[model samples]
Target: MIDAIRDYWNHRIHDLEMTDQPVGTKRFFEDLDEYRFDKLHYLPRLVDFSGFRGQRLLEVGCGIGTDLVRFAKGGARVTGVDLSQTAIDLARKNFELNGVNAEELVAGNGEALPYADASFDVVYGHGVIQYTADAPRLIQELHRVLKPGGTGLFMVYNRVSWLNALSKVMQVALEHEDAPVLTKYSIGEFRQLLAPFAETSIVPERFPVKSRLHKGWKGVAFNTMFVGTFNALPRAWVRPLGWHLMAMCRK
Candidate 1:
């Protein structure tokens, strides 16, 4: 099962790379600050990476190495591992393009990572854990690789959120086959999963405009309803009701 998924990802990334173009100069500048803002907003909420500076950092499932680039540029000696060879290639290319030097970028599975135990000061995976067949084993591997007091950061789809339930209805009842399946979790479930190796905290946060409305009145209505309901909530409440969940655990 893992091999099949890895193959699928490799093929998919290869295809994406063939047609890939850098985010245009204008759009890049506009979006650049937003990513930094997001990092700032979420970093404090997550674990502190500042203390881990000069220590080894490992990123799992680093698709095209976007965050990997950020980490390397931030000054930690970094290595990025992915199951997709195409992704590794693109990540290496991205490192060269961005003038950031990663310690290494290699192809490897999350289920069985290729590294020594207690090898990293921080293990980071953004939007990658939900796709795994076994979330526990994957987290265990992450734990095994972290040194004492090291931290791991993960971002996953929130199942309890309103947006997720709505997406399920639209996908099943409305026959939206193109919609992605997001594995959602309650705060308790998330904490339980990571309890083996570290103290855990789950921070729920919403990402506005995850996708655009499709076409007609139906799409517009759905979009408006979601925006109206969520937009008025206080930022403090937003995390618990948000579409995405982020967890930080210290080993």
Candidate 2:
């Protein structure tokens, strides 16, 4: 199962379809960065990309090192690991193109990471826990690698989210839905997975945004009708319907 997941990602880097820029070039990385932040507009508001200055950080499943580069530029000593060597290779080029240095970047499995216990000040695994073969094992490895009182930032799809329902209703598949492993968790289920943490807070985020991928009438309706109506509703009323569950955990 792990090998299958690795093989799948080895061919498909996240959001690779969004760009025509030459792969491994500066513009290619820039395009990906723009697309990511635009879609995940809540990311910077929630996670302090520049707040980890002078700290050691590890990003597991850091695809092409997009977020990792931001952490490095903000003065965090960053190391990245991915099961896909293709991503690691491109990540090296990404850091080089951006003129930022990373502590290291290697191709490795997240469930059994290659680092000492308590080795990092921050461990980040966004959009990765769900795709791994063993989510609990990967979570435990992330916890094991963090120093006492260190932070762990993670994200997984919300099983009981508006997007899930919309996908079913509209008969559209979520990105990577056909992967070897893709699990979604409810709020309570996600909290249970973070049991090793001393303290944790989960925020349901990734609300409706205008689509750049979906097309035809479905896209038009979602962009014209759904986005406005959803955002117009009182946030408190629709809070739990968010598509992504963002968790901030302390060891």
Candidate 3:
């Protein structure tokens, strides 16, 4: 099971080569910071890496090390793990290319982390656990590695989103296939997975992002019709329809 996903991501890394960032010409880290701000709005929330000076921070499933580089540049003692060696290697290159220092980048499973229990001040993962064979078990590992009261922030796809409906109608049910594990989490299900943590809360994130299914004006038009207008709707109205659900936990 693990090998299947690892191979999938390895092929993915080769095809995409790097994590997507906002296009601009700046110092590497500067570009990344702007990219994160525009996409994640992460200065004071969702793992709060900006406040992580001198703390031990672990990013499980740290793909290509984009966020790990940001945290390291902010002075966190950063460590990252990814199930794909292709991702791990690219992440190492990203850190070195930007002249940021991370404590380690290991290719490892989140379900059985290599570190000792209660060893980290912060554990973070984004768009990660849903793809693991056992999402609940990975949550246990997240709890295990955190110091008492340590923070864990994770994001997974929301099962009730427009994307979920569209994918089922246009991609899965239309083709007579089961939805993959990545599409498995409803808000209640994700909250239940995080229940064992000391204090856990879930919030919706990134209502529905623009799609890359096609390029140019056609893509823009599809996005405007299917997502853009709805994405701009105020959170109070769209909270329940959000495409990504963020879980914040303390262990």
Candidate 4:
């Protein structure tokens, strides 16, 4: 089943890349941002790792290597791994297009990574864990590859959020809800899951208004109200309202 899904996405990526598209265009951000807010949220957290001039960084599930290129441009010795061959090919092409030097691109599984213990200074998995069959095991693998006290940045779907709940309902209504709720995570639950390996911190963020599929002031009003209400309360109080969740863990 997993291999079949991998093949499906691989084909999708190949079709997407054949069109020769840019990364941050309106189409790219609009399509991906509905569920992924990492690009907006990463820069703030990455400020701490700004001086990674000679550091080694590993990215798991690096689709098309968009973020890999950014890490390379920032001077990190970078490697990207993905299950999709098409994504790997696009990543290599993107690396050349962006003029960023990357060490390697490996096609493999995230649950059982192919790197040695304590091999990398930083390990990143953004918007990737939700799709894995065993997220905790993947986290453990990430922990295994990091040097002691090294950092890891991960993004997962927020289970205890209004937007996610709505998405679930929508899927059910559309008769497209066969897949398990693989993308959802709550802060407390995630912390407990990562407790054995690293100290974890959760940051809740709002998907930007610009990326909404609905146009005009009505769309803006709805998203703004939702985010404002959700962010106004503490997680204990509003854990059931936000759209997505991000967790940053240190190994």
How does each model score on lDDT? Answer: 0.70, 0.96, 0.75, 0.67
Tens-digit per-residue lDDT, 1-251, candidate 1: 66766776766642232222354232342254345445336554454544456779999988777677767767788999888787788778778877879888999888788889999989998767776667889899999999999888888767677667776776523222222323557777877787875487777775554233255665776667766766667777666766667887789
- Measured by lDDT, the strongest candidate is 2
Q: Positional deviation of 9 in candidate 1, in angstroms?
A: 1.5
List model 3 lDDT by residue over 127-222, tens digit each: 778777788888899889999988888888788876577766654231112223454588888888898797888887765556443467656765
Tens-place lDDT per residue, model 2, 156-183, is 9999999999999999999999999999
Query: What does candidate 4's lDDT look like per residue over 1-53, in tens digits?
Result: 56865766576552243223365344443334323334266444533435577
**What TM-score would each prediction reach against the true structure?**
0.80, 0.99, 0.83, 0.76
For all candidates, the clash counts are 2, 0, 1, 1
RMSD of 1: 4.3
lDDT of 4: 0.67
User: Measured by TM-score, how close is model 1 to the native structure?
Assistant: 0.80
Candidate 1 vs candidate 2, lDDT winner: 2
The list of candidate 3 runs beyond 4 A from truth reads 14-37, 41-45, 169-183, 215-220
